[model samples]
Target: MTDVTEEFRLNLAHIDGPLAIATLTGDLDLHTAPGLRTGALEWIGQGHHHLILDLRGVGFCDSSGLSALIGVWHSAKQAGGALELAAAPDRLTRMLTLTGLDSLLTVHPTAQDVLSTHRPTADA
Candidate 1:
């Protein structure tokens, strides 16, 4: 069995005030989805609510990965923050649309675009 971390990488970066960019790489499957969820939740817990998931490097994402995304969105929302997707692959976008998650989660063309447009206020 492949190690979860070996198959996936989640790099968190703080950009544009309260916004956090989680740049994910590699396949996001059942083996690695939990780590993504946990890392995002930890970031949110630390008061970084506004999150942008940079999925450009993500080559594959399965149902479990989608579920983790939803869970992260909910966690961010509950923390008075928002979640957005940047540079998602075409297949992931299609899956999101098919599952109706596209409506619930905001998708941006690129992380730089999101940084330019969104200016989230710091939590008081």
Candidate 2:
């Protein structure tokens, strides 16, 4: 992969069943938030109500990113599903906690936790 690809800012991988993953790298800020919004909506439209965002690779995130996260959370809740974040950086975790969204959104320790701890919901 070239340096640009290696510097991946974001990626979304849709899985069967209810869960989909949004992997991010570089910085998740205002400039890149639109992409996140679009990708997340696509998965939601595809019947993936449950989402696990693997944010370990993300090096930075501002309020815009947090807005996107909240957007996903609300979208899932609206669709009768849940959106979880896996392995978020300390800063992101702190941000979510400070914003009081931590209690609203689910969080896991790792990507593996997404599968291992997943419980098939009745709604989605």
User: How close is each model in CA RMSD to the real structure?
Assistant: 2.4, 4.2
What's each prediction's TM-score? Answer: 0.90, 0.86
Please identify model 2 stretches exceeding 4 Å from their true place.
Answer: 1-8, 121-123
Choose the strongest candidate by TM-score.
1
User: What count of clashes does model 1 give?
Assistant: 0
lDDT by residue (tens digit), candidate 1, 1-124: 7544346899986655567898999988898999999999888887788999999999888889999999999999998888999999999999999989999888899999988988886652
Off by over 4 Å in 1: 1-6
Against the hidden true structure, what lDDT does model 1 obtain?
0.87
Highest lDDT: give the candidate number.
1
Model 2, range 1-124, lDDT digits (tens) per residue?
3222234466775475777777877777777777888888888888888888898888888888899889988988898778899999899999988888899876789878887888666556
| Residue 46 in candidate 2, Cα distance off native in Å | 0.6
